[model samples]
Target: MVSKSRSEWSTILSHLVLAAVSLHAAVTSAQSSRGAAAGFLLQTFAAITMLVPGLNTHEDCLAGAWVATVIGLPLLAFDFHWVNGDRSSANLLLGGGMVLAVAGDHLGPEGCSVAGQAVLLVVSVTILIVAVFTANTYGIWGGAMLGVAGLLSRLEEDRLLLLPKEDVCRWALTAGSWAYCRALHTQRLQWE
Candidate 1:
């Protein structure tokens, strides 16, 4: 029993490590277009592997993670590519990051598992970080959406930041959209 418990914990720890590493690679890749392809590949693999732990033992969480990964990866990758304009990339990343953040909220451990929630929060933040590095205002907005969602989720689960029970995730889809608009306006002004 003792060893089994240890093994389970080891698995959890491994997942955490994978998630963190992938996020790191993603952030690095987003910093610039140079060598972005390699970074994107690494990020993609790491993000998928990160959800492995929740697959067998935590199906619900796994589902959320899978949803987020499947949707977010392509969006993020496409947005990373220059699309004839800065605003487009920013908007795309914002939307993608928001999706990831909200999905992460549902990654709880069958109940009110604070640790599980925190992991999702980290994932969301990582998504936002990538958006920020790769884009501009849209990325910041994406980060904000993730932050707001995380906060609301915490509050819904229990207390606020200090306490927790379940993990509720949200991505200010609305806010991200607004940011995209604002970014476009600013871009127009700069160009003028």
Candidate 2:
């Protein structure tokens, strides 16, 4: 029991670290793209929510995290366009998907929330594919790491090396946010 408690504390610490990384990313990204910065800010909020006690066990907190992500991804995509000058209609699709996700989370049944998340995940992956095709190396890496984090989130009932899956998820999220910041910074440099 003591070991489990210690593990939980470690998980919380990991989430706190991710929150700090995300906040820093948001601040730095703000200089070149407010849209992307806002996305990172929302991500910071989502990470901070993981620090709340019984985060995984609490439905409300979990929903809050989902909602934040649902709202933030499009903003990130907006910045992706801003940096690359893609000017594609994909951003509209991203925004539409997120809006549906938010609506499902707030207005639909429980199953709707899950469906909404699935939609958002697909949208995120599509954006990542675009990043890869565009040769945005940092964006690709960041998207991959975040995808891993998302996958890990589904394995909350599992444990690895006696540590909760949440810890691994947090670490992945931290790395992803850092990579995204680098991506934004580098791309902004090229644009200027």
Candidate 3:
């Protein structure tokens, strides 16, 4: 029993490692096409493998994970299909989130004053709606890269830096970053 328990943990730990490594590679490669391609590939595999963990044991948490994945995954497949011009649901959650995030890409700390902040708040909240539904590495990685690029392009002392004026828009990216780190470090780290 003891060894069996250890083996199960080892399995879980392995998944965590792979998730982490993939996330790291994906995030680090955000600036280059080769990196982006590779990252996406890794993320694709990670999601596929993640789907099977619930089978090893039947627990409520695993069941919930499965349900969450099912609820969130179809849009990615659909989107990827459209991108390849194939029009299938192969990457559904990925597809839908991309559409939303791409549209919301413009809301950044730009000429933002009090009025601007109000507009940004509305936009960020809209973006967050899509972001919340995304549970995969693709959504997290994409958002992280977008946020990073947005921050760099804006390139200002006051705007780029998080400070007292911070609000949800300021930390809107925290979810993606948080998910990226956790996926890479905890789940993807162990992937073979």
Candidate 2 lowest-lDDT run of ten: 115-124
Estimated TM-score for each candidate: 0.31, 0.79, 0.26
lDDT of 1 by residue, 31-121 (tens): 3432333333443454345456444455554554444433443344334334324555545544655554565556455433443344335
TM-score of 1: 0.31
- What are the per-model C-alpha RMSD values against the true structure? 14.0, 3.4, 18.0
Query: Model 3 TM-score?
Result: 0.26
Q: Write the per-residue lDDT of candidate 2 for residues 119-170, one digit (tens) a residue.
A: 4455457557766877778878877877777776665377755677768767
Top lDDT hit: 2
lDDT of 2 at 75: 74
Give lDDT per model, in order. 0.44, 0.71, 0.37
Alpha carbon deviation, residue 153, candidate 1 (Å): 1.1
Off by over 4 Å in 2: 1-4, 52-59, 88-90, 105-113, 116-120, 155-157
Candidate 1 vs candidate 2: which has greater TM-score? Answer: 2
Backbone clash count for every predicted candidate, in the order shown: 1, 0, 36
| lDDT by residue for model 3 (38-106), tens | 433444344335436454343433333222222222332233233234443334344443453343324
